[model samples]
Target chain A: MTKTSVNLENPQGYPEVPPKTDSVSPIVSRVREVLRRHKFAYLSVGTYIASMVVFGLIVFAKGSNPFSVFAVVVQSTMFNGGSIEQIVLRTVPISLAALAVAVPARAGLVNVGGEGQLIMGAIGAAGVGLAVGASVPGPLTWVLMALAGGIAGAVWAGIPVLMRTATGASEAVTTLLMNFVANDIMLYLIYQPWRDRFSSGQPQSQPLSQSAQLPSLFGSQLNLGVVVALALVIATWYLLKRSHWGFALKVVGGNQEAARRAGLPISRLLISSMLVGGALAGLGGMLNFAGLEIQLVPGITATFGYIAFLASWLGRHDPYKVLIAASLFSAIALSSNGIQLNFGLNGSIVDILLALIVIAPLFLSKNRKALTK
Target chain B: MNGIEQTLIGGIAGGTAIVIPALGELTSELSGIVNLGTEGCMLAGALGAYAVTVATGSAEIGIAGGAVAGAIFGLLHAYLTVYRKADQLTSGLVIWFLALGVTGVLGTGYVNDAITPLPIVSVPGLSQVPWLGPILFRQDLLVYVGYFLVALIIFVLHRSRIGLLLRATGERPEVVSVAGIHPNVIQVVAVTVGALLAGIGGAQLSVGYVGTWFDDMTSGYGFVAVAVVLFASWRPLRVMVGAYVFGVALSAESVLQTNGIAINQYLLDALPYLVTLIALVVVSRRGGRKAPEALSRALTDVT
Candidate 1:
């Protein structure tokens, strides 16, 4: 008879006994195995904790009670229903803007011009709304503003896209450069041509007519933007992960030479990806403009493009994950207002927290494996 | 004398800030690291220098403070990208955001502070020489140092063993390792030193140029420096030329404003970025600079 060896995790007729797993309990070992498999979840939690601790130190250094600061942050953002509404409202634009980054990323492009594209979208929407919003029916006004916004965003993204494909200029740099140009253009408009003469204080455009505002959800504080955002999230998930075009984009992004050899329209696919991203960002602008701030103003984005860019990275470019990340970031951002009110801390402290959260993941995991691959 | 001579003088002085940072970025890129945080490093330097100057009443010491601040940032970048193997661009952007926030938080007390600007000096003989004299000779102390640095960097990069190793590391780290040198160590040194220079540049901007502290006072000069490095083809002398071109543009803004010209200040603010975008496209199309092989890998799109 052959010699038989006994297994440690389980043994014949000994299923009830704990394995020789370092003399640990069977349930404990099983839980350890699950934790090992889901290291990313732990990594994110660890990073979040580390960031909050660092932020607490900052608050403490400023002579505020760190615990109270944290409590205020949590209470102001999480406990109240009104804050949740603001977070969800903020998520609408952020999620759409994140999709802007996510889509182009699929085609092997970094669309750092989200800020510019979003601003252009807002400008387009404002132009259309101010021009024809009152003359047209409300529904038609919405349609026209959205189209203008989307087309403008596409045009903005198209500039760097054209430069990249035609001249090999790095889109990362070019797109970033465009943000300054877009900002200046907006400033020029508001400071002069588009200035609302009837208003005082900070310069802003004329407010959209009441009819042009986003319709409320059954007389609730919520508007149609969140619903639209959700629909787009699902739609983008389908198109990017399920369709042949999406498959082509993957091939192009993964290996350009392979895409070329496979007869994929590499340039078209790349361009289309970026254009759709720009359009989505523009649509985000329209939603925000109609849904909340009814007028074009400086600081309109509140760095939405940048925060959304970070959110895209946090989500690893998955549209569904991006939405969640967007919501989370929105909560973090809106907390700044409360923090400032409560502690008199500078508003930019939120940037430090966001930076810390984004940076922690950079080094915590297996080096290259943790990149946005 | 008209504003033309004054503009030329201002151009050389203002250009010094940009040329210094561009040289720093060139050094970093030659080591296979594209630090997008050069912007943040400059901000760190600007605030550090300004704060130090306010405390000690010494612009010279403040510039040193700036260099130290920049080095700290550089060290963080080196650790993240070189040691931890984090994506270079991501590490860079995060550092920049951190710098932006930190400076904003710390720079509050110095917003209204003032200092004695770097004194303008002239070489007596050079000052006597026609059109070039007043234009070139009459510049702040940092401008002269900037000239020396440009010449020194050109010699070091093209002719020195260290630069050869740096270029080798950027092109092929495997080869660098085979040659019995630690490539990452060299890269760390190069990046840190590069960042130190950028800090000095920021110090020049605040203590040497404007003599006052303000939020984002460096504006986007650091970014322009990065662009300048690219169009300069990583050449030190061309970096000066590129920087001076921007300096002229910036000084032109001031000159036009002082003359009561009607161009919108906001539109004028956009000029540098627009020009950078246009120049980048033009230079890239012409193949004016060859990017390091490693840099191309660093910038590869990730999803």
Candidate 2:
């Protein structure tokens, strides 16, 4: 279809010539737009910086020298072995979930059910691990468990897509509702069938065999999952930039009507996006389970999946950008632990501090001024 | 059966969580802006009020604090959804993540007490009457207000001029624009008002019902509110009915567990959602009646 026309010439009931204004050079104008958008991104970065400054002030208020606290936060998160391990462990899930969400986002579908999908995948993989942890060899058990996790996560996500395609229901509501459903399923598995026979009444599963565990790649709480996450990031970047399927997904994501008119199968594309996204999220869950926790319990996801959603947005849906954003958030998350230990800070303050990072960008965009009445 | 009475009581008590948010969501949906951030808004309000009440020892102030927090969330949402022309769904999801993360961090400083919620105010003569009296009149003040809000919303939506205009904005915003009313202003008002009510609903949970706020106290109440809105077909009064149904199911599961019944608590907890899913299927089969035509369109378009 042609672009809709506007009656731009009509002014005060008379045709008028367009008024000329001071114009920037084309290169300069393009540079300004780039700078303006980057300004928004930096606005977000500033909040991250501001939060650290605020944390320092809070430490000063509590009678500690601000410099010492800053040094402690920096040194612990950046140089301390244990803190670095925490950052590495945290990065795997955040990066994987961000990619999980970004892929579907690139395809124009929203998967708020990432938390649920991750939980379901964990449950799926945990069930597989527990059932076969005793008999299967190490490598095959890990692969099969990861596959089970991916399949379970995909199926959990598929429910919403199916409902959307079949009944024209909004996926936002359905996928969100499905989070509770997946959580309940996880609860049931842990509390009932999967409850470790030797455990006292806590809602947890039996420990997997040593063979079911992922091998540590760095021997510093960093596991082979980090390798897998980095590899996936590179693979995802290539697939989106070079693959035909990725191109189709992006087309359908950006505009379904346009994609449909161009002979793309919208339904198939939507479903495939959900599957891939769900699989990535599930893989994140599998990594969390095998690489870090090694057990399924209530609050198993620890809301990390949701944090990853923010990281994905911060990255603007670019896998490479996602890596940087994830690492930044990982640092911020590490600082929370340091702040708690050194300054007796409350843990939840991390969220309040992070809010600044999430919110400042909206105000910083040049378009923001133009959009508001 | 006596079993049904217990379920109804539990449902009404439990369903209060859904009523306010769903009603507020209906307003937003009516104005053609889907506030997917409702859950986050509610959670923030709940946590904010809970912490404030415990710290200050005043429920009213706590409730107001929740409202303020919720309004701030609404303002952010308006800025992104209306001003920036970002995808409403994405912006909402972002707000939710930010809220969840921030609440988790800030809540560490808060040491909350077990809430002694507002007592149920039984209307004297009405509460003295038989079953209906005890069931309806002998309820918490918020429950009564919830019903009243439903009636008020129904009247506002169908009869009032502002309501008509709001409906028009949702259904055919272009028509409203042709009449010289800015659709964005209408949407902002709708979302703000809706968020305010949702905030109250969450506050009611902290200071009026459950009497305590834990991390993530909302437990997907906002998500259920969406389902309630759809189940009610976006009507104010019907949403109350839907909320009551869901409330009853949720309450019944807990009661069953308390009574040591052999029924699976897991299955029971899943019941309300399963029913909601089924209701969604049925609603879709019938086709949504007179919904906002431009509900899912980009906010820049008046229609």
Candidate 3:
């Protein structure tokens, strides 16, 4: 049997005292407590430093100058104009994907299906846009695709939420399982049903018509999805921090039994949180497709959803902070290209850096129910 | 061989890989630590086995290397969850990422390298048996070990005092602690042993089954093993059955492709996970109260 109740032990991410160490500067520790609002920033910076050190050792072991390679990574990722645009473009999907995780997390649910949700969103968007054809106006196509993607994402996410509500299945496991299924679903479509007529060998869906594409911004590499992502971030902040629904969800998350006794509609809050999360992820997938990728391609999601999962945890499930975490992760993920071309390392080595950063904060966090329920 | 023959022949060996890990997972889950990073352990083991086998000419030693490699990942997970009290699912997922990256970087040079696979040996007397002989007796040393391990785990987990201690830890650690036995020690040991076997499973895939090392090559087998443990309801025998079921799903994908059938390979690739999802739902709906009492209460608890 799985968890009888939603196992939400730690809502405040890493709310533990820093492990006492000579390296933990007194000033930093004081700042973490004084500027509680900026604690995530400090946590990120700390994680970044720790990851760099570990990454340096790895590079050194590989017979490379860690300092020089890191210099290249930072310079290429932050200073180069084209690189900056790519990072921003990457952030569009990542931020929305992180929001996909963050929203559900606010209700004490872990929505690890962001990757699957995003893929479904892309498939939904592509299917709708292709069917709408070039006859439809550009703005109309966008709305229709967004709706299709959002609904597809919501439905995908809803399946797991339903399973969790009905049977105490852990959302974490079910959602992760759904991701692979979603990818296969996409592969099946592109392989036969949605196979592009013009493309050969590499199976892909038909490219969206020119009118269906999201417009690029100011002749740069980025698209108008940036604005959409930003607006959603602000909206999430308001909803999570200010709204009645948000309060109800929090009540449910904080104490399910208490919320139920209070007649706050516990199951409704859980389902609504997950639905919003899934819809955002779907929107992310659609935006990524229409904005950057011209057509459905293999590995298109490219671990964007996974990184966004880490980003949400990094942000402690707050919308504004998630935006920052997404941006940081976007930079790190984009730096993979630089590392790949220079160090001749596999592109996936970046996951080590990201994983290190994410896990570092766990050492300090105190889960009140860590050893007890 | 006919298509059905090929699936059975292929599935038994493939099933060895999953069942090994599933058995290991059963041990840890019984001790109350649900290590989702079993996938990471398998990946690490696959690479470790391959690299060691390449460096040394012994597949036997490679299997040991694989066990050690997997155990390290398991140990890390144990530390994070058991001592650090980090969230188990998150920690498990992060461990997978860490293993994926580490293996990807380390296995880069071995991508094109190859090793001589473990030769299959059939039991002389058993080989002549009507049907069960070929499917059960004809396999590599690792497959034989898997068979032995299953019987060993089932017997030890049920009949031994240690098994009772382990099961007791999962049920209520506080009560176990009251009996003067530290539950954390037992949990650490159980999780490590589970990972050790999972690593051997990876070695079985690389050295005994596939004979090649590739990045993320275990695919979803590691995860499937985790799901198998869940649906198997922590029963060792049922876990083995579940593993074989997924094993056939994997084999059918290849068998259909080889038979010139036009079914979508990707769709076939998804069947195991879909089945796993459905199994979790269906089993849970049936009052799935077979988990350790403590574990079922706090899903993320490692204590």
Candidate 4:
């Protein structure tokens, strides 16, 4: 493909030159073309920088030196040992959540139900653990919990997929509303039948047995969830970029009519993609539950699903890129504690930064397009 | 006087909280732009209104401030979604995040303070009636404002030339452009106006209802408002009914609690959202024939 394309003149209306006195080398011209194609990337980076300056001004308005806040943020999030581990732990759920969105996004479907799916997954895993933690072997119990979590997530996501396919309802709104429902269901369970009997006061589920908990990594605060998340990321990257099913799903996403014409099972592909995305999110929930919480409680996901949605968009729905974006966002989120402690600022200040990061590119790219025109 | 009567009155008041935003969303949807950021706008409006009302000791000024704050965010939304051609849902979500953060930061001071709430106006003659009087005649000023706004919206939507243009733009922008009106301008105006109303709704929630400031206080009213528009099938009068129904569902928790019913508070809290999801499915299954053509295309057509 490259060899065939290399000999073809740039179709963007660049002037043809005589071969005799060509001033630009072919390699340089190719490099320039690549750069031009990625102009939006450059603009997005510029916007990120501009947003940071605006955030600094906001800090100033709060009566603190922006530099000091930044120093504290960076020192705590990046330079510290415990904070780095915290970011890694946080990244596990966030990256998986991003993948949950990214996988379905490749098929031109927006699966915003990651939050619901994650919660359901956690509930599913917890249910399994509670039912057989004492009777089943440790490794078998863990395996069953993971499978239940994945299946639960898939089924949770499957509801919206079916709604979209059968009735043409907007999955975006339905998935979002389902998040609240999932939260309520989780709350009901913890507050009632699943409530830890021995523990008084706060409403929480009984703790998972030792067999149900995930093993930590290298004696660090980080758990094996990171390994699971990274493995899923690599597998997703392969499936999206190389697999035949991935190609078919992309075709379906690109044009349903064309895919139908090509004899692809459109509904099957759509449902499968959504299910895979949901399962990934569910697994993230299971990982979070098994690795960190060890008990079902409210706020277990901590809005990781929403943050992951932002990360997916920032990464342009690429699995590898989403991994990087999710890590960056998780770091910033982990550092918000320091910002709150040092500057007396609300921890939600990180949300403002995240919002700006998402929006700046839109405005900048628009300006660039107008300028180019 | 009784549980049923009290619940009915509370329902009307709670329903009004959603009505303003739902109305705003209807207008926005009619113009082919869906601003999910209505939630964010409402949050900002609530904080802005509460802060100003606390400062000046005037609820009216606070309401106006809320509208202004909402309009500002609406302008940002319009600029991004309209001019920049960003994804409407994503842009709306980002706007919401921004509002949540900004309000959370600025509203900390006002959390402990309270402002004088808008007084309920009772018509001397009409309010004397037993069953309907307290529920309808005796209410806050915003309820009356909502009534007038609904009537105005219905008339304008059905009878006016601008309304024709708005509907046409949502159905087919190319045709509207061919007819010499810029669709983008109409969209911007529609979204901003919608946000302004949503802000007012937020103001109503804080000043007229809660009479205090809080961070992220709009909850999911903005999203529920969006659902209400869909449930109403984008009609003005139906939006009123939908809002009232949701209000009844929302107020049920307190009413039941007051009556000593043994129900989980969290389940009650989840009722409105559950209803919304069910309503969406039911409505869609019945065929969403009333949805704008262009808006549907905007949601489904990727590329």
Chain A TM-score for each of the predictions: 0.89, 0.82, 0.86, 0.87
* Candidate 1 wrongly placed segments (more than 4 Å): A1-44, A365-373
- Each model's lDDT: 0.85, 0.77, 0.86, 0.87
Model 3: DockQ against the native? 0.49
lDDT of candidate 1 over A1-373, digit per residue (tens): 9978877656665658554457888899899999887877887788778877887898788889999977887899999778988999999889988999899899889887788888888888888888885777898898888899899889889888888888888888888788888888888888888889999899998899888888989887779877988998999999899999998999999999999999998888988999999999988988888888888898799878888888998898999899998998899899998888988877777778888888787766453375336
Error of 3 at A308 (Å): 1.6
Instruction: Please write out the lDDT profile of model 3 over residues B1-303, one tens digit for every residue.
Output: 578877887788999999999999889888888888899999999999998999998888999999999999999888877887777777788888999999998999998887888889999999778777787788899888988998999889889988989999999887788768899999999999999998999999999889999889898788889888888788888888888878877888899998889888999999888888998898878866578876665563211
Task: Give every collision pair in model 3.
Answer: none
List TM-score per model, in order.
0.92, 0.86, 0.91, 0.92
**What DockQ, on C-alphas, does every prediction get?**
0.64, 0.38, 0.49, 0.65
Residues B1-303 of candidate 2 have per-residue lDDT tens digits of 376677676678668878988899899989888887788888878877877777688776788878777777877787777666656765676667667765665665564466556677889898877777777777777788788888899989999988998999888777888767888888888988888778878887777767776778888788788777875778787788888888888878877887789876776777888778778877776777745777756422210
Ranking the candidates on lDDT from highest down gives 4, 3, 1, 2
Task: Please give the TM-score of chain B in predicted model 4.
Answer: 0.97
Tens-digit lDDT track for model 1 on B12-71? Answer: 888888988888999999889988888889889988988888889888889989999988
Better of 1 and 4 by TM-score: 1
TM-scores of chain B, in order = 0.96, 0.92, 0.96, 0.97
Model 4: colliding residue pairs: none
Candidate 4: tens digits of C-alpha lDDT, residues A1-373: 4554444456565777756855799899888898788877777777888989998898889899999988998999989878888898888888888898988888888877788899999999999999887787877887898899999999888988888888777887888888888888899889988999998888799999996688888898988888888999999999999999999989988888999999999888889999999999999899989888899988888778888888897788999999999999899888889989888898888888788888886676466556568
Model 2 — interface RMS deviation? Answer: 4.3
User: Which sections of candidate 2 miss by over 4 Å?
Assistant: A1-73, A197-202, A365-373, B48-65, B101-115, B171-181, B298-303
Q: How many times do residue backbones clash in model 1? A: 0
lDDT tens per residue, model 2, A1-373: 9986666666346656588864878899888888786865566577567756765565566567878766766887888867777887888877877787788777777777788888877887898898886696889999998999889888888888888778767666777788788788778877778887887877688787888999997556788888888888898888777899899988887777899899999898888888888888888888888878888888887677667777887788889998888887777777877777876755555665455565555445435445454
